[model samples]
Target: MKNRHTPCTECRKQRRKCIQISPDQPCLRCQKLDKICARPENCALDPNNEVECLNQEVNELNQAIQRMEHELKTLGIKSPLYIKNNTMTLPRSTIENLFYNWKIKINNGYFTIDTGIKYISDLLPHYTSIEYLSPMTSYSSSSSEDSWSDGGSILIRFKSQEYGGFYGLTGKMLTKWIKKRMLGQQALLINHIPCGSRMLLDRLVDIYFNCHNLYCGWLHESSFRKRYSQLKEPLDDLICASLCCYVCATPCDHLDFNAYQRRDMCDYFYLKAKEKLVDQFDEPDKRLENICLDLRSEYEAAKVQTGIDYALFARHFSVAYCLRITLDCVVNKPITRQPIPFPVMNTLPDELEETKDFIRVMTWVNHLYEEPFVDMLVEQIHLILIGSTCTISFETVARMDQFLLDFGKNIPSEWRLCDNVFDEAKCRKALDQTTNPVAIHAFLHFAVLIVILYVTILQPVSVNDENDLLLQHIQRNALEKSLKMSRLLLYGVQRLFKLKTLSPCHVKLTSMIIMLYLVDPIVLQCSSPIKSSVLEAQKMFQKCLDIICNIRGIQREDTPPQLLAEKKDIKDFIHNGSVDIDYYDRFPDPWCALLHDVSQFFI
Candidate 1:
């Protein structure tokens, strides 16, 4: 065996001689230290290797210098003296540290150059940039037009090529600010009972599977259980909150059951879920991937078992359920005195497929469950789709009209007659005494649909330029029929309102009153002859508004600012004897506004 003349790596690092028995074996010192013996000959340094290594290092240094200069330019530093002084040689690590500290200060609203300089100087005294000392007070603004308000919020202005004049803080800044706001907002443990209790867990799971599963069934039952059992202190909070929300949402049979406890549990868990969801949204990549994977697996299994593409359906259902639970908790709690829009109408337009899927599922579920609430939900979906801001084709309008006609045909002859000639006092007495939840829910949906139909009849129609007198006559006849239908529907609404069966604050009910108010203006502005009845109709609509506001605990002052503004314009038009049908077109339909409020649920 050849003797090892070259020292080992460790010995070379320590500047000591290495002793080895052979070239193949480790040195005694390396063996004692339990380190692998490395030989200098194994490296076999070449003249070209040294040159290449030096070049690489030099290139890295140049890149670092360029980055520093670019950063200085971005920070609005342009003084020649500062640039020359700051060009001092700095190690990569020191440059990196300075850049990081600079970013931290900017994010924290410490924007002054002098303060940044002081901070960086303390961080790296030996590697100060000459630009830091420049007395140039003015800095170059961001390429993206932005303005900082006194409130410490930055409003970014987008070009017309983008989403023009879009003003908001950057995503990162908004997330940081929100986190700072929610710093002390801890999830409250209202229930003293341990979450791991088997009895409670079983009951909650059963309730979830039985009732809430149809809509919010994203979590894989088996996987969730396995993960939940293994979770420790911190993570268990989310599990507990999620389970509790499901349990609390179950409809209880006992009249004496403590509703307050359920409310508290729902509230706490909703807050936790909302916070978690926001955090998931802010993640750079693989955001909510774990949850999505689980949901996908469940959906696949469901498709195999049910033979239906429930993937899109389930996603929307779960989202809507989450939003609904959160909104319900908030509405019941009422953090503010201002009236909140009805939760059903608050869906986002981006979730077009989701909304369609939700509606389809609701229609199917109504037949399967025969649940009054599900039926009501289907009707609400119908209203939302009809009132959608998206352009509706003639075919879609025809379909909607056909659906309404079909619905009308399904009503009992006696019920249809009662709608037009029912005794207001008797109806009121019966509604007050009615105890059936299903009946009350059904009536609410039915009445809302009637009112929506009434308003829909007044929607302006477009005529082709080539249409002759024949088409005009046909249109007039159709309009008269629609007016008759509206009058019949109005009678039903009056009876229902008089009975006080539904809350006036209920969005559907409030929207009905608004629709009625719109009817008079619409008819009066039409080319059709205005009789004395038009004046009476206007007086009656005002009376209805006054009554509903008084009954529903909504003061005139509590009305939405936009609605109030519109009402004032309408009043002014009446006073000036002017009829502007264009006024109605300018403002969004009230029903569409209501729909936008609840659209987040479907998303």
Candidate 2:
């Protein structure tokens, strides 16, 4: 007998031969019956084979489902808003909720830079106060889980100190003071840039995105590039110019420019930006130059006010008072203004929508923190005037100390600092801890402020006051505080340098920290633990220098005299494990000079 194909289920049921035109087509008998042409083997009607047949059908169905799923997954991988494991990578609801919670916090001023914990213990809460998650029940025992879910963290209310109210110096008055005093200071002014190539400008902007924007995130990369390419408005040019200023101020080996070249380029860009914004200084814009002006004001204030100089104090005080009362009426008002609206927050396209949303929110959050933090810094500078007249009083010292402590407490959880740096582990924690560069800036500033305050308190006694014993005690305390804070400051600067986030402006801050170790007689006279701390600081400072050297290109004898001299000092310190302290005092760096002038209120 000749071999033949099997009959279909319907044909076999009828005991008829199944006829088909092709293997892929339905059998003629099944087509006539309007039924599926199942294979004859699958059509077995024996009771024993029934379950096997159903099982085969079920397996076939499962295979088909899997093939479809695989195709879907493949498509998902190509999609921007991909879903994985039956869930969105970043759900719209989740982003919306996070943004809502953040807004609530902002509206309540809960996340404000100046809002400290009501109790200091809140920073390091006891384990007993914490709630743990209970195992697999209908209920969770942890209140923290619910609190976090509901966006209801503990709210701490603390007393806000009169920051810039001591001398009635307003932000406006301070701005005027800087502009007025800076008029004839041609050497300090950012020089005008003649011109530049679009190619070079583009390269600098790229450098900014790769280096600065990674840590700062102040500029949304895609949005900035897009806007810059268009150059639709003067604001865009101004923004680009400012960004170039920042990049030029820092040495970039890739830029192949020496320190002087970079400085000149930075000055050029800065001057261009300044000319554009010359009329808008009083406007409420988060132009970085404004916060920068605080630094300049401190410099000018230090320049004008010196050790026990009543005549100089009277003259500037009168000028400042006149400016405050007549020219700037907002002198005594608290700085509660919101940051200028973000340009790209709403304008960004839908591609990588979740990431864009996050960037937008974080940019706003950074701005929110920056304003108050800068205000507090200005207040700290104004407070320096009190110390400038005479030795800072014990009450003033205590208040200032409390203010700093409170400020530390108020820092966001992600950026919060460990106050005690005496412990090696804590110092490492501070150094190892990572956050945004803006936070790093805040950390460095805070440390600098602490060092300045304590250094002011430890001034030499010219005529012994009645509080001589108390003075000695305060001096000892100030020395210890300054040492601890200086260590913290060095660790911060080291971190900043390591991140490639340190700018020339930050170099000034770094120098101030290093000066504490290089000079400061009280710190120098200390024993083992303090010596160890100083050694640790020296190592960190060396690390910062190494990073700077690496980026700016290696130190060379052919380097400028000033740069070479500084390099030699660093080399000597590295080899001898000590510095020529008198060498620093005799021919101080600009930062050291500013530091000396500011802290010149010795009794």
Candidate 3:
């Protein structure tokens, strides 16, 4: 028992005013911290203990002061007076507040730090108003509307010159920025595509507008056609080649080009586009006025797909983040435009219903990508992973599960998955009804995320009481429902792949899901009766590999020796079921490690 006036050791160390619950119990601070509360014995007589405790406190305070000073030096604050002097620019408190808010935004994964010209624009609020003014004159509010209207067009003559400076200069700057940021393979020289038939070119262009244009929606049809028809500049070729390359890489059907021909064409266009993209970076004087604002962002996004596939998630996320920041600048702007109608899409034949469904699903997915909720979801998951101060209870998990169910219910009937079964005929029917592959992918991802949540927090317990039994039952039901949902969505995705209606993006998503999400479950369940699930997962994995094999379409016999060998290596590995883990050593660390982790079981 401690004296009533004595404080706990923890409270004394922290210099907190502690209130004792009782003389025999811990102090309030120690109790709240779940720490042992020690009080000095015979405090009046034990002069050494008091001196030692005081010395310890002084040492700790000195260490803390040293740490803070070190942090201040690292932050470029030489001393307290240095920060005080800098208050002329921004008060220390204000700066600290800004930094604190910025940190919170970063931790929550929903922040935008404008870089380059965007930052300059943010600094100059009146930039747009004075953009067309002569450099010699100071910008004035009194400038005539007529003068502005007349000169705005002259100064910004080409749409490419909308951002001012030399034509295509921003593109060059962006390219450099991208290169600087990239951690993986740097793009080099790309060869131009050989001349092809006029009909083939037109078909590719048409396919892009009808099937794929919605995903990026970068180029306005009228503007793109105006430039594309003339072909007077590299922008026309860049847009055409990039779109053609993307379409060819994904699921598309054409009567003129055989599988081999299509593969060759895709390679040519992709390489040509890559060359053009490099030229965009290399040639500063090149005209890019025709490139739309959306196209510039798409240029970054295109790297995510047509480059090394889904291997660079960081790069993919970087592009998404850059796009978010770019949009956030104008998110609050009061501007409204009438929705552009897609008459060409309406004229599409019934046979392309699956493709249309794909477009819808991808568009929705892209929409979700631009939303802030994804960031919140990711941040919450991260907190849960790190076991942060905030505790998310099983009831919260149940609520989230219910929320997902409610969301699924609210989805249009046409977009809903039919069931978990992967029947060909039924899947085909469901595909016709459900046109959004992105939604299917999202459902699968969300289910997996929920299962992960359950696994992360679940603990072993004995069912000795009603509460224990209830907890066990909830855990069982939650896991089962989540796993079933995942299986159902996975099956749905499999159906799409089998039907050859899924896009290249889906291929990327599938690869990510298998490599990152499915491996553990499949491996752990191999010895269980649910071995059938493992087999299904294997089939899904095989389908992805098959897609990769034919990814560039069928290659001609004259394909380069290296590419031929590369294709052979993957093909043989897939068929032989070998455990040569070194075969995948070329992949990024995560992929290589994960593939190696699950190779034996999957094989």
- The alpha-carbon RMSD values of the candidates against the true structure, listed in the order shown, are 23.3, 30.6, 25.7
The backbone clash count of each candidate, in order, is 16, 2, 4
Where does candidate 3 stray beyond 4 Å? 1-200, 214-219, 233-236, 255-268, 278-374, 380-398, 412-479, 494-601
State in Å the error of residue 275, model 2. Answer: 4.1
Instruction: Choose 1 or 2, whichever is better by lDDT.
Output: 2
lDDT, model 2: 0.46
Question: Candidate 1, TM-score vs. the true structure?
Answer: 0.31
Model 2 CA deviation exceeding 4 Å by range:
1-195, 220-223, 232-236, 278-387, 390-393, 399-412, 417-425, 429-445, 460-465, 495-603
The pairs that clash in candidate 3 are 159-289, 160-289, 357-435, 361-436
> What does candidate 2's lDDT look like per residue over 28-132, in tens digits?
757755788877544335654655665676666668769977876566555543332234234466546433543212221122323233222232232211211
Please, what's the RMSD in Å of model 1?
Answer: 23.3
TM-scores for candidates 1 onward, in order: 0.31, 0.40, 0.40
State the lDDT of candidate 3 residue by residue for 507-593, as single tens digits.
Answer: 543544443444443333232234565465466444434533443243444334553255223333333333333333222221332
Q: Write the per-residue lDDT of candidate 1 for residues 6-59, one digit (tens) a residue.
A: 688887876656888876889887886687888776544565665676667666
Report the lDDT of model 2 for residue 349: 42
Error of 1 at 475 (Å): 4.8
Error (Å) of candidate 2 at residue 60 is 99
